[model samples]
Structure formats: structure tokens, C-alpha cells
Target: MVVLPATLVPRLDFIPSKPHQRDGYEPEFRRGILFEIDLRTFLATLITVGSYVRIMISNLGRIGWAVVFAVLIALTIPWFLWGDGRVAYGLPVWLWWHIGWMIVVSLVFTLFANRAWGTGIEEGA
Candidate 1:
């Protein structure tokens, strides 16, 4: 059910490997369901983290650093929700909920990717 953004060129944004694309394809379905599932999983994780950050901000009455995090999360919702058009214009409650979730989940993703790819911090170095 996760349809990538219409703006996205398949090979460029996702499924970079031809073999992965071929394996995921189904003539009847048009695309593999695995993509949708993966998207959902990532989103769900983000929302969870956002909730925690929100609580921290609420208690502290917000701060400059908190605002920075909030802005970053706001920017990311559209990026991740890219191809889910209806998702951008659904019920207000649902939209807010998902947006919040995505913020947290994305931060987690950033941390995980950095560690996995050895981006910023070098382990034991």
C-alpha cells in the first residue's frame, strides 16, 4: 500500500538494484507489498520516538534546542510521506498523529544509519 511519491523515479529513489526490483515485481500487483510494509514499520518507529520528545518539551516549556528538533521533524513528514498523497490530506487528527510519530522514528533512523554506516562517530576511535 505504500506507493512512493509520484515525483520519485523508482530506480533513483528506491530499489536501486535491478535484481531487487525484478524480485519485487508482480504483474498483477504492480509492485511488491514488501515496500509498503517496510514503510509502515519505519513510520511506526518514528511516531513512538516523537511522542517521547513531545513529552519532554511539554514539561520544560520548550527551548531553543527543542524548537530545532520540532522543525526538523516537520520537514521530514513530507519527505517520508512522499508518495502517499492522500496521507498528506487526510483527517487532521490522523495527520498530526502520524507527523509526530514520523519525527521520532526518523531521528531513530538517523542514529541507526549513522552507526551502521560509520558516518559521524567512529567506533573506538
Candidate 2:
């Protein structure tokens, strides 16, 4: 979702006017590092919880995205554990294998999201 992407990826800002001699461009993200982390945590948790609640309420008869959620969890668990602190923290060769696995699983879930909830995974404009 857009909110998750915004929270996860670093934000970039543009200059007020055109190119300036003194500076090229400066990012004006939230002031501190903790601010970024805390906001991301809050946003991610809120979205995840809210989505879960919505699905349970509206689709009691229909089974939900069991496989997608399961795959996300299954892959994410070992991914963080795969690394040796500094070196493989960013999903090395084998972890990337898991990521590739997730990609395949996510496509199936995308169709499921579209069909079940009438919400396309493409999201916003």
C-alpha cells in the first residue's frame, strides 16, 4: 500500500525554486531518526491490523488471503535470520531466493485481493 511504501522508503524533497548556486538540493524529511522509525512502526501496524479487521467483518463467509499472509510471514521470518549481522542483513543470495518465492506467491494473492475484496493491487493513481 501507499502508506506502507511511504513509511518504509526514505522521503525526498525538491528545492523551493530552480537550481541554486549555493546548494543543489536538500532533503527535508522528518527531523530525527527515531521519528522515522516510530512513525513507520505505527503506520505499518495500523494498516495491518485494520486490514485484518476489515476482512473478518466483511467476508465472514469467504475465506481470506490465508496463503498470502502465510507466505509473507514465512519468508520474512528467515530473511532477518539469514544474515550474519552486518554482512547478509539485506537479503543475500539465498534470502533473495525466498524473496523470489514471495514474488510468485504475491501475484497469486494479487488476484485473490482483486477477486475477493474488489480492490485491485495496483492501488492508487
Candidate 3:
């Protein structure tokens, strides 16, 4: 079989230096305000929230149902107080408050799932 010459291959360094030089068009990223900060902060918050969830689940076996129920009720009832608050980050304060509450509820549900549902499958089964 005949082999092709190496000189025929295109070199990356020889390519146009700029986008406009290569294709006569410059592309824009168009990232909105707070894009970078928002992503970093969101990831950090998610990690912190996950740690809290793990702690909550670990403690579930010790806390009584009454305490859990009380906390659940207290969290739910606070929504009324959040109404008519000043806006933050383009969303009503109450909306952000509820979003935080939802995260707690989700962690509580995770605890319940682990304790009440037995983590789904057995090691041997």
C-alpha cells in the first residue's frame, strides 16, 4: 500500500490566529450578569446543603417523631410571615424563603427515605 506524505497534513499553528481571520466572524459568549459568580456560589451552596443533609439523616435515628413533626410544622407555618417582604435578586423575599424551606424539606425527606424505606435494596438481596 502507498503511504501519504506528512507535509500534506494541516498544522494547527499555521491556522488563522483569530476567529475573524479564520471565518470573518467573531462569536460572542453573551453570559448574563452574575453568571460566573452565580455558578460558583450555587455550587458552593449545593455542597454546604449536601453536608447538612448528611448530618440530618445521620441524626434521624436519634430524634423522636414528635420533634420532627414539630419542626416540619414550624417550617411550613413561617410562609405567612414571609409575605409582603422586600424583593431580593429579582425575586420576592418570600419566594427565596420558600426555596430554602423546600431544600430543608427535601433533606428531611431524604432522612425519612433512609430510615423508613431502608435505602431500597439489601446488601445480600
Best by lDDT: 3
Model 1, range 1-125, lDDT digits (tens) per residue? 45544344234335322223466673443443223325676578789979887666544533443565576667655565455545445555457756677777777668646634332244321
Rank the candidate models, highest TM-score first.
Answer: 3, 2, 1
lDDT of 3 by residue, 2-115 (tens): 221224323434333222223665665222221222445656777999989876765564456447757877877565655486889998877787889888888988877676
- Give one clash count per candidate, in the order shown: 6, 0, 0
Shift of residue 76 alpha carbon in model 3, Å: 0.9
Q: Quantify all predictions' global Cα lDDT against the true fold.
A: 0.52, 0.53, 0.57
List the candidate 3 regions with Cα displacement exceeding 4 Å.
Answer: 1-63, 79-83, 118-125
- Tens digit of lDDT per residue, candidate 2, span 64-101? 46555665667665654465444356655676566777
In model 2, where is the ten-residue run with the lowest total lDDT? 13-22
lDDT of 1 at 100: 79
Q: Give the top-scoring candidate (TM-score).
A: 3
Using lDDT as the measure, name the better of candidate 2 and candidate 3.
Answer: 3
What local lDDT score does residue 106 receive in model 1, on the 0 to 100 scale? 78
